[model samples]
Target: MEAVAKLNNYPTSPRKMRLLADMIRGMEVEKALAQLEHNPKHPAVPLRKLVVSAISNWKQKNEGGDESTLIVKTIFVDGARTIKRMRPAPQGRGYRVRKRSNHVTVIVDTK
Candidate 1:
């Protein structure tokens, strides 16, 4: 059995979030949470929260089952739409500004 969780519009860019997601791929649920909790990166907090959500999903899917048996089977981060705007520069010039967002998906499966 498998469960999935997603976090949309995360404040971090997809590139940055991908770095953290790569570290947790194919890891057990417990170890993934531990790594995220101890990591100093800004993206860890959101990733940790998503991991917890995925665990909850697993628990819900398998009633009365042990969460310890669940493992993170896949984690993926994708680029979302970027909000673009123009910033006025000196001497009547304008610069394009891009505000980035990301979508994160985590899937867990039980042994």
Candidate 2:
């Protein structure tokens, strides 16, 4: 059985979030949370929270289950809506700036 958690419209680029997601994929749940907690990355904070939430969700779904055997089975980040803004440039020109967002899905399962 697997437990899944999703975070949508996260205000970070998919490329940046993928770096952290790749590290936790296939790792033990406890170890993954620890890594995210210690890592000095903006996205890691929310990722850790999502993992904790997933753990609780698993517990609620499966009564009398052991959490120690849980592992981060799959995690992925995908591009989401982009916010576009205009930045003032030299010579009275405007430059388009794209603020990217992403959605992340994490699935934890018993090993």
RMSD of each: 1.2, 0.6
lDDT per residue as tens, model 1, 28-108: 899999999999999999999999999998888889988888888999999998999999999999999999999999999
- Residue 10, candidate 1: how far off, in angstroms? 1.0
lDDT of 2 by residue, 75-106 (tens): 99999999999999999999999999999999
Among all windows of ten consecutive residues in candidate 2, which has the lowest summed lDDT? Answer: 53-62
Every candidate's lDDT: 0.93, 0.95
TM-scores, one per candidate: 0.93, 0.98
Please give the distance, in angstroms, between residue 101's alpha carbon in candidate 2 and its true position after superposition. Answer: 0.7
What residue runs in model 2 are displaced by over 4 Å at the alpha carbon?
A: none
Clashes of 2: 0
